[model samples]
Target: MPDKDAGTPRVFLVRHGETEWTISGRYTGRSDIPLTPDGEHQVSSSAGVIVGPGRIIDPSKITHLFISPRTRARRTYELLFDESAQKMIEGKSETTEDIREWEYGAYEGLLTAHIRAARKERGLDKERPWNIWVDGCEEGESADEVSNRLDSIIAKIREIQGPYMHGEKGADVVLIAHGHILRAFAKRWIGFPLSTSLPMMLEPGAVGVLSYEHHKVDEPAFLLGVNMGGSR
Candidate 1:
């Protein structure tokens, strides 16, 4: 476990750009989907605005990057960082399964409406609506399971930032992953349960910041006013 110190170390959560399933609002889990042309362009254009010298994610200060193994996520990672930053991140980055999208299982590739209709037909939750945070997906990961996995990763991140807290001025970590998992990660980062946290909307190519309030690691909080900088 890392020591909770008064330092401004931050974590940047980057959701992958658009994909076929993403555009269609289909549940994409273990399936490896590539980003669409627009997705690539969106991420590519965001690099300068979000990751340059004075940007939210200072490329030079990035200590480590955790990227998802999925194609869309990896591609998004490549597009988000420029060549110089890529070189700096080469040895510090690793592809981890912990950051992959939520496993949709039987609900994979099904749109939200279709899943709801199927659930209604199957006599599941006839009165109430389906919520992934509570109901989760049939034969898939529960919200608690997702929270646990993200907690493990967050612990690792804290461990990595421990030494840098006292020594360096900037020790930033970056995570490039899918929408649901990243949103869940942000909630867990702030020690909030999925059911309790407000619903967060993370568009493709959008970025979110997670850091400590008052520079205390024990006081984790999400940074607000994170503009995507330009049209996506």
Candidate 2:
């Protein structure tokens, strides 16, 4: 394998900016709510910090974009990359349902506390409180189902990034989606089961990087910490 950091391909996971549901702590799956005014500002401000040249996620380094079909995600992409930057990667970008938010089903638009209360009222989770990772949503996707979905995406991403492990260029990929789905994708990226309870969190409008250890494609890993004093 090449040097640990040489030309290693990376996946940048971006959770969409805040929505009313996000602030309210509601499950926002497939509801299609727009970002709040603060959300728009948040994404725009983030772009200025991380999406510029020599910043954390330079637009020029983005080889491909896999964006969720949700309006909030698409709008995040719009505000994230300026018109010039968008034009730069327009041909390589794709809007995909594969990366959409986790389906919440009956739990949609309900807060976690309320979901647990409802489940308790219905005699569910008496063994323990409701846990999305382990118990999943009623009438929605199970942990295994979500794992299967994300595993397929990881396969496609690896295919695109495998060739670049040896310092090849143009292999940085970006995924724009929701909080739970992106966190789930990170777990699946590292071969962890959805019920593993890794305690990972991706804040709205924040960016996280997934890459391989020692420039080896088979050794998938993620940056636990980074110092951004200079060029990314």
RMSD of each: 4.7, 2.0
Off by over 4 Å in 2: 1-3, 229-232
lDDT of 1 by residue, 122-143 (tens): 8988778788888777799999
lDDT of 2 by residue, 1-232 (tens): 5235756778999999999999999999999999999999989998988787767776777788999999999999999999989877879898988899999999999988998888889888878998999988889889899999889889988988888787567688999999999999999999999999799878899989889988788999987764464244
Name the weakest run of 10 consecutive residues (lDDT summed) in model 2.
223-232
Native-structure RMSD, model 2 = 2.0
The collision pairs in model 1 are: none
Q: Evaluate residue 95 in candidate 1 and report its C-alpha lDDT on the 0 to 100 scale.
A: 95
Q: lDDT of model 2 at residue 95? A: 93
Residue 197 lDDT (model 2): 76
Instruction: For candidate 1, give the lDDT of residue 226.
Output: 50
**Residue-level error in angstroms, candidate 2, position 28:** 0.4
